[model samples]
Structures are given as structure tokens and as C-alpha cells.
Target: MGKKFFEESELIINADGSIFHLHIKPEQLAHKIILVGDPGRVSLVASHFNEIESEVESREFRSITGRYNNKRITVTSTGIGCDNIDIVMNEIDALANIDFNSRQEKENFTELEIVRIGTCGGLQPHTPIGTYICSEKSIGFDGLLNFYAGRNAVCDLKLERALLNHLGWSGNMCAPAPYAINSDKELADRISGNDMIKGITVACGGFFGPQGRQLRLPLADPNQNEKIESFRYDGMCITNFEMESSALAGLARLMGHKATTVCMVIANRYAKEANTGYKNKIDDLITKVLDRI
Candidate 1:
């Protein structure tokens, strides 16, 4: 037979009694999820967990579930960009919902709170290398959700329009696409820390030429990151740069799940900021965030 509808194949066992994808079932999750873009970082984050539970890996997807602050949670590696985010989010959605009979019409889903903890580049000089940015909103530069039905549903539409108007960003071939911010204010507020600097973050499409690195390739849009920082929606600011937060936030809101991303300032591109104790900052930031979350 072909692929079965409502099959939790990559979440629950299909062939035999086994956890699929990350090789974990719904019961393995802790309702609170912490995501990292690197598979190795999954274990790094889980090290802070109270109960050192099972560590499982499938492809770039590594998972460690345990307790922190007496709160149950799971840390999973989402690999690289929006494509990986798409996979991890969908699989996680499947894990949370129980559709054992393969039903299609019901739209069964269990709400889960997800937070992405990753490293990103600082767009503005104020966003120090040691700081963490909680996205108040994300600008979808990746077009990952360009095909989704409600593209701007998770974003600040007034902010988006204001940004476009302020930066005159509406006419470029790669126009600024809208992104979703976290819907739960309490969740966002509860997650912020000294290192957790919360603001708007732009989810770039690529790492090299797209993010404004010459890297031996022809230029499509040179000086784009600067242009990105030049963007503003009234007083609302775009804080940092990364690859996935926009789509993650957007899709999560579309599906009625709460999501946000907290990124470390590893590189400060403007003012030639590369390594001002960036590593030490990342190490401390990870420890602090994981301990609290």
C-alpha cells in the first residue's frame, strides 16, 4: 500500500514498535520544546536537564528529554534552515497528536509550546556579542512560507508596512516578506533573561551571498544586510539575523501553536565586529538559557 493517512510513521512506530524520525514517540516529549539548529547542540542543551534521559539521533535530528526548573522539556536539533524547520515542526506536530486510526477529516492537534535557541549575527551595534534576542517579530527574507495561505498572519502588519515604507523596501526583487511573532506574551516575557534580549529578528534565506558574504559567488543582492538594518517599522526594530525563525513563527501561529526564537550574538557584521569574546558569550548564554528554561 501507499503512504497511509494519519500514519505516525516518523513519530510513532509503523513497521514495528519503535519511535520514528528522532526515534521518539509522543510520550517522550515534555510539552515544552527547546530547539537548536545543530544536532550536537541538542546534547549540549540537554546536559542541563535534571534527569538525563535517553539521547536519540536520526540524521541531523537529535533529541534529549529531561527536566529543568522542575519543568519537563525536550531539546531537539533542527539542523540548518527553514527546510529543516519545516521537517522538525511537522514531525513534532505529529508526535503531539494521536491519530492512531489514520483519520483525515478531524484535524486533530495537541497544542505544544516551542522555543528555538540558536546563535545569530548582530545587525545593530547595541546587540552585543554576549546578548540574546527574543524575536518580537521576524521578517521572512527566506520565502519559506510564500506558498502558505496566511503569510502575514503571525507578523505585525503595521510594522511590516511601516518597515517597507521607511526603508523603501517594497520594490526589490527579493522584497521583504512578513513573519510571525510569538502569540503568547507570557511565554515571551517568561523566557527573557539578561542575555535574552527580545526584539525583531530577520530570517535570511541563506548564509553566504544571500546574507552578504562574497564567498566566491556572483552577487544577487550586495549590501542586503545593511539594507535589512535600514528597515524599520516606526519605532519597532529588527534586531538580528538568522535562517529559520520567521517560518517557524509563522507556521506555528497558523496552526495555533506558540513559537519563538532566542539567538546569541555570535557575529556582529556591522562596524567589523567578528570576535569580541563571541565564543565565551555563546557558552555562557547557552548555560544561562538552558538552566532557566
Candidate 2:
């Protein structure tokens, strides 16, 4: 590592040449990365590795790289939300494609294969608790992609327009404008193994307010859950709700990387059921995803 070229305000890197937030170097990361929302889950995924190589941690982000069945894989925790995804994705891409010493992009870019394995609430009554499903498309209510350029080209404009029209969306609504994007089909297919249910996933900005979970505060749209449950476009129904998949899929597509999400249905909102003992299910999902990826 040499003297820093990027400004501290623009791009922050540690003295050891690791990225600021992730505390990871380019060589430590693998091309195939597994992203989870919980820092504790990092080791859970790495537990399947045949041999451990490296481990790094910074704040809520934790990373481990090792060989899984002779295949190199990196597992990292992103904490939560598209907000966190913004930071993690950019920094990871920088670690892979940016020359830290020169503060510029490398001549040859690396396209990462990103897979998000997490837990979500099933919106549909049919998708029961403890079910594992892969997202075919993700609808984002977080508005992360709106801040970036060239979003229209990466988003599914037709689906967005259809959803807007169907929902009677107005500027007055408290919800942010929604954008839809499809997951990388190749990755979804591989992860699903034709055994999991594939449906649209909605990524909300907040767990309570945006997800229509009313506790102490009232929602602007009280019928948000009902609306989402009834929403269908191109024969696809909204299946589940989570916090990060939309931005993961959207930003990955914009960056020319392959991304997909496989989540365990821990709660069924319509069925009024929740699985308190979902650790075994999650472990099984982790094994399945690790085997595929």
C-alpha cells in the first residue's frame, strides 16, 4: 500500500489499505460473495467452509473468506436496509475495481456474484412460515436507486408503471416512489434448484412504518399490506417483504454484477403466524445456497 490518493471525504481507506467501512482488502474478497443482514450470521455461513482463510470486521460489517467444497467464497454481513447496502456495495465494488493508490477505476473491472440470504415475512397466505423462497423480482420502496444516475435503464419501467397505476399512487402518499427490478435469472435459477417458490419481493425502507406494522404510530396507508397482497403483474404476485433485497438486486444490476436473494419465511402476516425457531430452517437454507453458489 502507498500514499492515499482519494480524498478522505470522497473515499476513505484505512492506513493498511483496507476499505473504510468493511475493513477489507481486494485480495481478501472472493468473486462470489454471500451477503447477510446479521453480523453473527457471517460465521454461520462460514461454518460450512472446508478451510478458513481470513476474517475481518468493522462496525456492523463482518467478513470471512474460505474454501467451500474447493470453491472460494466470501461471506459478509451488511447489517440492514438499502442505506447500508449503498455503502457496502460501493465499497466492495471499489475494493474489486478501483485502484486505491491511483484513486481511479482499474482498467479491467471485476463482476461479482452477490447472493443475499436472509429472513422475511410472507405476505401471501400460501407461503407459510419456514418456507424458503427466491425472489424473481424485487420492488423497492426505499428510494435508494432514485439517487443514482442511469436507474431507469436498470429498472423494470413497465412493471413500475403498472404498479403505480394499480396502486393509484400519488405524490401525496407517505410511501416513497416504488421501482421494480428483476434478480439475475442465472443466479436465481441456480439457487432455487427448481425446488423453491419464486415470486416478487418488496423491500421496505423501515421495518415498521414502511412495512405496515402498526404499533404505536399510525400509517399513512393503513391498507398497505392488503394492497401489496393483492398486487399482481405479469402473472407474478407479491410474495414477501424484507429490508434489503431491492437495493441489492437493483445496485448489483446497475453495476453489471449478478445478484439474487433467497430468504426464509419466518412470519406469515396474513396467516397470523410466526416461527420463533427458524434457526434450523435458516441453517438448511445456508447449506442449500452454499452448495449452489
Highest TM-score model number: 2
Location of the lowest summed lDDT over 10 successive residues in candidate 1: 98-107
Regions of candidate 2 where Cα sits further than 4 Å from its true position: 1-6
TM values, all candidates? 0.85, 0.96
| lDDT at residue 95 of model 1 (Cα atoms) | 66
Reference-based lDDT, each prediction: 0.72, 0.91
138-254 per-residue lDDT for model 2 (tens digits): 999989999889999989999898888777785546547988999999999999997799999999998998888999998887987888899889898999999999999999999
Model 1's alpha-carbon lDDT is 0.72
- lDDT string for model 1 (146-244, tens) is 777876665567766776665556776566565545535666676775546777887877887767778778776575667777765556567888898
| Cα error of candidate 2 at position 126, Å | 2.0
At residue 128, what lDDT does model 2 achieve? 95
